[model samples]
Target: METIQAIYDFLQTRTWLQVNDPEEQIVFLAAGEYNENYLITVEEIYGTARHVFRINHGSQLGLANQIEYEFAVLRALARSGVTPRPYYCEPDPGFDELGNGVLLMEYLPGRPLDYAKDWREAASIFAAVHAQPVDDRLIPQPDPVRDIARECEGLIGRYPDHPMTEARDRLLRYRERVLETADEFQTLTADDKPVMANTEVNSHNFLIDDETGRGWLVDWEKCVVTSRFQDLGHFLVPTTTLWKTDFEFGREGRRDFVAAYLELCRAKAGSGMDLETALRCTEIMERTILLRAISWCYMAHYEYTQDGRALRNEDTFARIEQYLDRMAWFFESKT
Candidate 1:
């Protein structure tokens, strides 16, 4: 409720919603440190009105960086023609200096998209997103390998004290391997173009239609100017477990996704990235992800095995081990 009040007070003061009005019909939606989103319907002396506000409670990141990233995502989505309709975004200083930060925009109305029914459709959506020309104007440059390496090292340093020391150590070593692999790989993918690459493309990031095959990607917080292969890899690898489920597209889905991506890259040659370069990018992306997966395994193992929690989740460890093996095989096959 504190968060809701924060949003209300923040909004009330803005000229958009005259602070002195007592007849405002404001409604509470959702709030979090990431950002507080609200759907408000107000009635004036004349008629009814509606507004969707994104109260930017971006305490998790620096104010400037948070605001810039949000704006960038909106811009990228607008450019790609793949995002929900956004009416307005409250700019920085939209809230009290220390109390709150928010971004106001239109609220999209629709049921969440189902991943099982639309993995390929989702991949194609990303293909379309990547199809757009890379905007050098949006997002800062990133050193994927180095940044990931540093994260792996951080995990390694904590291994001694971590409950899943063994798994964490494996992850640490894997990270080192990936960095080494990237160093020897000469034909890495690089582009100075604008990209709508979303780093976190998990199942939860999408909203699906049960009747139609259409999907919309959400939470563009981590959208960056990274390789398109990285986006595809995120979609394919994390959900690799789908191979075991009834879901038709786990491993097979990933393969098809990769194929589709390669085809798209080939089709858009002069645009920037092509098939061969995307494959190399895929390798780099996989190396980075495998390290993270191994770390996740470490985290899960420690949390479960050591704490005596998730005892029934041994199957998870086995699955993780299989994932690692496949990654190892992938490395050897490419080499």
Candidate 2:
């Protein structure tokens, strides 16, 4: 109740919202590990309006301007029509009610993407979202595969040292296989264009509009400057899809998705992305994204188990356990 009132109180501070004269509301939408979302509705002078009030826990990017950075990225991608338009940002910490920080953006109309129906829309969404130009504001990852492996090593370093010794050793062995094949595919494409990659592209992060059937990608908390291949590869990999869903695409379906992505990438004239070379870079990401996924589960599972995160999802913990149990199934070398 206090949190909701705080949101309304914050709105009252905003002259544009006119909280007193308007039929205003702030309802809790959802809460994730890093942030809590609320749907803000108001009857403004123009018309009924809605936006998401995203309250941050802290800096996931390890930068001072984390919220501002996300707002900026959203603003840049707003023109692309694939992301939400950022409305306001309160990056300064220690406000009356908004803890850490908060940002407001257009409340996108849609539901969590359904793999069976929304696959093609997802491909187009990723293509258009990645087509947006990249800049230095986002964290630059020149060698994404190596970077992923390094992060895995870090995440794994936490376990087997304690209660998860077996899981740790198991993940470590599979990670070695991932690391060995890391260099097999060319990391850098011919064009060498760095994309504004949404590192976390799970099905839940994507939304499909009911009426228009348009795709919308949300949750840019893990946004980075990396190869678009990394984004596409993560979306294709089972480790990602299996997180919130059990619907797995067959080999032919994957081939079709990649073809659509390639075609869509080529179609976006303003994206400045090279289709042929990017396809090559994407190939490298396929083999490496798993390593990151495994290590992430191991680390996050441990963290969530130990009450490391503020918001804990038992469903996520169960899936992490499943992934850890079958490390080979997810990451085994195909050759």
Candidate 3:
């Protein structure tokens, strides 16, 4: 209640608009993987217009900067009409007691894309997002493969010992493969150009407007400037399989999605992206995405076990095993 009141009080301080029943208007929405989301509806005193506030509480350490960067990204994409409008953002000092950071943005009214029916739209939306020009200062331009390799190295160092020997062995093997693949991928796309890539391309991150049928990509915290294929692989591979079973695409669906993306690229006259090279990059990045997933499991396991949250150990190990199984399946299918 105090936190809610604090948010309400903070909202009242803003000079842009007047709050309409701040106490009663604030409603808790779904909590995301990294942040708690709240909806605040306010009415303008000068008119009959009502604006919804998407208040996001970013509690993680490094996420405060991510929230700020997301604001910048949204601002850059404002003219593109594919992202929610960012209104305000505050770092840790502003909401020290409640969260590490807070971001208030326009509440987009839409539902998550239904992958089976919306894959083509999803591809088009991503292509449009990637095509937008962004200030290089706000978005990081890191080598995707080297970045994943660093993450693997960090996870190994952070968790020197694993509770489950089998899990540890799997992680070690996965890291080795990732490093080798990264080397090859670097050689394969040495001259590849970077684009505005959403490092996290899950289905839930995309919201399709019910009225316009246009897709809006939300949750820009993981947005970066990288190879377009990195985003493409993440979207078409793990993301499709993770959330909805109905959205899982077989060979035909995958082909159609790729076709749509390529067609859009051609229509937009995308520079530095060729069909042959992009296809090759996609194939390599799919394996990189698998390794990235495994790295996430390792990080989660380390955090869960080290934070005195042993109760979640079983679930964490289960997730690691599942990712390993997926990785093995991927390799087997490729062979």
Candidate 4:
């Protein structure tokens, strides 16, 4: 209740709002990897409004000015209309008992994306975001292939107690392949232009409104300056699409999704990329993303196995197990 009281007191500072009862007005929303979200409902000058009070525990980008960086990106993408609008940001709110940083933003209305039905809608959201100007403040990942290799090495290295099972060896082999074809991967993205991209584009990261039919990608903790394909690939890869949902598409469906994104980008003012180039980029990006995802599953599986995670979801564990047990499918899809 201490956190609730602090939030109530904080809401009072928003001179433009009317919070009759903080306990009734503020509600716990969700706890993410780095922050706790509180849905704040207050009567604004015009009418009732909803905003998210995000308490940041840390930054995935490892920025000292994490809140500032995130808010900057939010503000930059506001014009794109696919992301939430930022109202205020306090990197240090002096919340010795609550959080390291705070962000107040417009609360969007929607539910976690349903991959089975909302694939094209999800593509539209990414297309709108990818159309936005790239923020120079973001850390650019120019070399995703090498980046995935290094990340795999770090995550897989920590599992010393784990045996070198076939799955582990295969994961390592993927890393070796990425490193070996490093030059080709570089060439694939050499002509690419940087865009505002969310590296984490899994199903849950996106929201689709049933009535209004609007789509949004709400989580930006992993946002970066990178090739648009990084996000598109993440969204399309089986590792992601099948993570939160069991939806899978053969080559035809994958082609159609990219085609939808291409058309949307063209509508957004004639994108510099065409269907063929985007398809090629998406293909290569998925290959490296597979390596990255398996490595992550290994790290997470070990953590969950050791009860290192503060919160564990049976669904997540089940999905990770499926990925490891049926590793052949993930590898075969790389081709």
Candidate 5:
């Protein structure tokens, strides 16, 4: 109740909008791994006009910076009519007891995309994002291969005596081999151009409106200027199945998605990337994706176990082992 009042009072000072009944109107929407999200539907006092508020709660470390970056990207993409319009960004709203950052943006209407039914459309949305010219000052370009290796090394260094010490060491060696293999294809992608990539391309981040059959890409916190294949490979990987249940594309379906994206790229002109180059880049990027997922799984386990003192639940341990097995299989396949 107090939080609602704080939000209402904060909004009142900025605009003429009024929340007559904050308790009934402001509602909890959903929660993500890092933030608590809320929605408030506001109605005009004299007319039937209504507006929705998307309140993103960021209370974690380094989140304040992420919110700023997300706002910048959202503002840029909003001009293209495919992202939500960011209205206000409070990096540290001191009024909140927890001192969490708040991002006030227009609430978009849609549900999580069904990948199996909307693969083509999803690929098209990604192509559209890639088509836009990027301002390098706003979004930093990432070295896909090097960045993943550095992150994995950091995660492994955090836990030196975990029960799976041997597995972790082996994974590190495998990461090196993968990096070597990726270098072989470096020449193929040497001339690749950078584009805006939503490094996190989970199906849930893509909101699809059933009526219009159009999709809006949300969650730009991880947005970066990188190889288009970084985004494309993330979309086509089987790991997406973890978040998107309907994501069960076989080799042919995967090929179809690449075809759709490449056609769009060619149509845009001056993209300077051809079908063969795109496929090779995608193959290299996919390996980096696996390395990234491996790091995330290990980090999650470390965090859950409180630096290795606590015991993790069976299901949680099983999932972690499964990811480890997948990483090992990838390494063996390369050899």
Candidate 6:
């Protein structure tokens, strides 16, 4: 109650009034990795309106340059053809003295996208974002290949624990295969189709409206400038049976999805990439995901609880090893 009072006091200091009406009071929305978000209708001395604010109170990343990040997001969205409109950003000055920073912006209303139905639209959104000429200041200058390699190394470093003991060597074996494949990946030719690399184009990141069937691509945290195929691989690989979901696409179905995307890209750009090359790209992405999953399996065992229950440490590693083998098979099958 004291903390809530303090927040109210802070808002009062800002000359904002908390409307007591059900539609006007702040309502807790979704909780993210670091921040607790709120959807509130605030009234000022002169005007009233609804706004969304994310309070990063318990974030390990803290709110360092968060307002700047939101500004970056706003810039990125305005530049990109397929993104949301960011209305405002609350700066974080004394957040460290209090807690994590708070970022307030306009709330967008829409339904979340269905990955299976909207895969092409999602890919097209990334394609358009990547196609946009990026401001070097907003772009994080990092070597994509090197960045991915470092991520792989971090995953490999987590091995040899109790859960991964039996599977450590196996995972390493797959890593070696991917290393060999990486050299070949360089030889594969792709049109210099621009793709926004920074965005994580996973299923949950997109929102769609049921009425108009328009999809909104959100979450620009990992937006990057990279090859179009990389984005395609990331978008396509997961739609396959790689992850367990109520929605599943069979081998042929997945292949067709990739094919359709290629056609869409070619139709727009005049030269789409070949299937074999796309498969190779998928291999590279699948390898990266495999390594991350391997790390996650170990972390889940040693650190976190799953579904409010302690996960079996050994079982997690076993699943990772099994998935590693599955990926290796996927690679060899492609070959």
Top candidate, metric lDDT = 4
Q: How does model 6 fare in lDDT? A: 0.54
Candidate 5 error regions (>4 Å): 1-6, 45-64, 97-99, 307-335
The Cα local distance difference test for each model comes to: 0.56, 0.76, 0.66, 0.80, 0.68, 0.54
TM-score for every candidate vs. truth? 0.68, 0.89, 0.84, 0.89, 0.84, 0.71
List model 5 lDDT by residue over 1-335, tens digit each.
66667777776665535567778777667555455566776666565443434344442223447667777777777765677778877666566631345677777778887777888888778878877778665655456677667766777776666677766878688688668755655567677667878878888788899998888888776777777788887787665555446445676776788888888777776456666667767767777776766766776676666654222445546666676667666555334
Error of 4 at 118 (Å): 2.3
TM-score of 1: 0.68
lDDT against true structure, model 2: 0.76
User: Model 4: per-residue lDDT, tens digit, 214-282?
Assistant: 988887877888778888888888998888777877788889999998898889866567778778878
The residue pairs that clash in candidate 2, if any, are 160-165
Which sections of candidate 1 miss by over 4 Å?
15-33, 41-52, 55-64, 85-100, 141-143, 155-164, 184-194, 210-213, 239-250, 262-280, 293-335
Residue 181 lDDT (model 3): 64
- Which tens-of-lDDT digit does each residue in 1-335 have in candidate 6? 33344444455546344545443366666554434556677677677666665565331212366545645655766766467566645554244422445555556556655666776676566556655665565444233334555555565564335464545566566566556655555556433444446435656567676777666676554455555555655555542334434454457755776677677667666776688677666656655544544544444444433344222335435555455546446444433
Q: Candidate 1 — worst ten consecutive residues by lDDT sum?
A: 239-248
Query: Could you arrange the candidates by lDDT from highest to lowest?
Result: 4, 2, 5, 3, 1, 6
Better of 1 and 6 by TM-score: 6
User: What is the Å distance of residue 81 in model 6 from its true position?
Assistant: 4.5
Which pairs of residues collide in candidate 3? none
Candidate 1 local lDDT, 268-308, one digit each (tens): 65454455555556656766765665555454444444543
For model 2, residues 33-105, the per-residue Cα lDDT tens digits are 7788988787877899888989887665666677788887887788778888888888763565576788888
The per-residue C-alpha lDDT of model 6 at residue 18 equals 59
What is the lDDT, from 0 to 100, of the residue 214 in candidate 3?
Answer: 82
